[model samples]
Target: MRRSRAADPRGRAADRGSRTVTLTGLVAATALTASLTAACGGGTSTDTEGGNTDPKTLTYWATNQGASLEHDKKVLTPELKKFERQTGIKVKLEVIPWSDLLNRILAATTSGQGPDVLNIGNTWSASLQATGALLPFDDKTFAKIGGKDRFVPSALASTGTAGKDPAAVPLYSLAYGLYYNKARFDEAGIDEPPATWSELVAAGRKLTKGGKYGLAVEGANLAENSHHAFVFSQQHGGDFFDSEGKPTFTTAANVKAVKQYVDLLAGDKIAAPGNAEYAQNQSLKDFATGKAAMLLWQAADTTLKSHGMKPGDYGIAPVPVQSGAPGQGRNVNSMVAGINISVFKNSDNLDGALKFVKFMTSDTEQKHLNSTYGAIPPVKSAQDGGTFSTPAQKVLRETLATSAAPLPQVPDESKFETLVGTAMKELFADAAAGRQVTEKSVRDRLAKAQQQMQS
Candidate 1:
């Protein structure tokens, strides 16, 4: 019953190699915070009627990776210029917010106004691949980019579903980690971060004092709820879907998993009720500030830095499980989190787009880009040493290699995130309002999601 790990809609994804779970139940991103909705409509001002076909020019849609959109532009500008100088191909880069990227890409797919190249959450790999809008990296295409072996085997796994050519190439790799406020832990006399869920709760109760909370959760964000739901379900040895990919969301284990998570607020009373109002990135803010003592996030080093948290302010550890040490199955700690570089199949400048992907995946670019963003490079060589060998990186990298699992590789994986995550959101709302969050209540909500999916 127990299986392995996996992101945000703005984006989360990971590779599933030898440890791949054929089970269809585990489909949700604990990857970095992904915005489930796009706030500002969709589409850029230009690129209205298909992409720029100019052989020497290419357009790329980059996800928000830095402290702010402006920061990303500052980081990527010179890199794009460097690529231009090397290949004589000009890159038109648009930094899309995580909030609207998926919708914008879908709009681009339907209207054919997308860019030549773009980044996608690895969680969307199979779903997007099913649309047949992305270029497939077949053996021939893999050869074009220094062979398929050039990438970390696990990162490559999230590129798409099994037995098919990857719909994209892994660029920046990530995995979830438990980040704790060092001083808070020290003040509480907790010598180390939590190793088990029970220990986490005990630590949380001790940390909850003076109007501050022990933990934070993006309780209102559907994508965030869905991710934790999937993760907690994994710890409880439950599956959201059966082997044939049908909804199985109301299992006993599922109820137990959902209850435990909600009980953090309803039962244990560690997380604040205000967390139920958190949808954007407030949980992150809460942890960055002193409002909360701990946070579980996908590669949050850069974001923490942006929030004015000094490097030594916090420490990273594996997300806690029910019990035992983290290895796989029940011991698995983090879901795969990463971004993928893809070429639109309809692009007029496919060559340039492919070249751009190759360039980004190159060891040099991977090093600079991943290091700059505090993300791990999916390229095997780039992951070997250097910045990736740091203390924080070692935690994330080890998780990806040994414990990280992919979300379901189903075409409708995104829908699972939406429906189930939303269902959990409503439950949290009820909990925040002082309503009883019972096992039966959790089951009823999940059953409704199952019915909606069937409908």
Candidate 2:
């Protein structure tokens, strides 16, 4: 879920670039926190006196989605002021860097000291919900914000565990796309963007002649690699987990997908040899600087411009599929969800927190915030209102509504990331070193990763 920093326009400057957490440590910490809360009489109470409906002030921890904390403050302060004018409740906004947000949230969960409301990566919804530290939006509570039917189905599905109350609601949305250098394609005489796996390889071969490789890949970034694996696997009719949330990384469909992905470097030779060391940022650089003819990313318009690539220089298209696959690989993509909003269960100002959450997801605010950050709004009405004016953004909006899905929703999501991402890193290394990356090798590594998860 944590793929590229650039993909998330939010200021993740504080994120250590890893979401890995030890399940044992988390359980121990939660148990200790619960014990302390009971001893101190600090847990949330169900009585009328316990729920503070009319608080004078509310604390909000916002993820940095702009150039800096200052930038986000500039964008959000006016909105908070509007909320105060309308509700007589002042919001104390604290912009937390991505690096520190998760740890801070965990500590807050244990200490019963946290902001009334906050923004979280959508992928963390299920894991956080499992903690029971978040305020669940049931039918009565959901009406205060908006009807559940108001949100995009795919985006809304990511808010929590399926068939249960979601711990959060979608605030912003994003999706994966294939970006290409139009000029390079024209020069290579490639009439259209590749629409299938075989076509992609053929196009890459033609685009490979010039010092530039045909495709830029983030082989070194495990998160990015894991995402690519998910996309490829989905195209092959496979999923990372079963319906019961058990990991299925060693499935035949997944093995075929991973082998095809590794083949880009090991077999097709479309990506550069050094790409094994490239992170998302590095891969973007390669494409922006004309070192590669194509790249796959999400919410890349802003970053592409920042890197000096012009609007006319690139074109956005749906990710290529395996044409020979069943149903022509329709509706398959890298699982995606953007940022989501959540309220802490232990907050004294529950009323103010819920109101703020609603206000943030309201059509006006969704448009304002997503427009400033260049991301797609999560609300169906906002998306339909022509909020995304750019060709790329529009494409992403369609992709989210039609094809995108949340990553495997399991409490061990962080563990899934580690196992799959680490395996991908090693696989890329082998390919870069010119080792024979057979299908058996790929399957064996996946089998080992699956075993570690079980152990």
The TM-score, computed over Cα atoms with residue i paired to residue i, of candidate 2 is: 0.86
- For model 1, the stretches where C-alpha displacement exceeds 4 angstroms are 1-6, 13-53, 326-329
- In model 2, residue pairs whose N, Cα or C atoms come closer than 3 Å (at least 3 residues apart or on different chains), thus clashing, are 11-64, 14-99, 15-98, 15-99
By how many angstroms RMSD does model 1 differ from the true structure? Answer: 6.8
Instruction: Report the C-alpha lDDT of model 1 over 1-455, residue by residue, as the tens digit.
Output: 00011247424422111011111222322121222221111223234343443678888998777667788899899999999999999888898765566667766665556688888777778877876778889999888887898888877877787889999998888787888999999999999998888999999999999999999977766666666777788877777878887888899988888888888887888999989877655777799998999987776666677798886999988888888664334765665667888987767776677788889999999999888877888888887776888898899888889876666766766677777877778888898999999988999999998987776
Superposition error at 172 for model 2 (Å): 0.7
Q: Once model 1 is optimally superposed onto the true structure by TM-score, how far is the C-alpha of residue 36 displaced, in angstroms?
A: 24
TM-score of each model, in listed order: 0.89, 0.86
Query: Over 4 Å off in model 2, which ranges?
Result: 2-50, 64-74, 94-100, 324-331
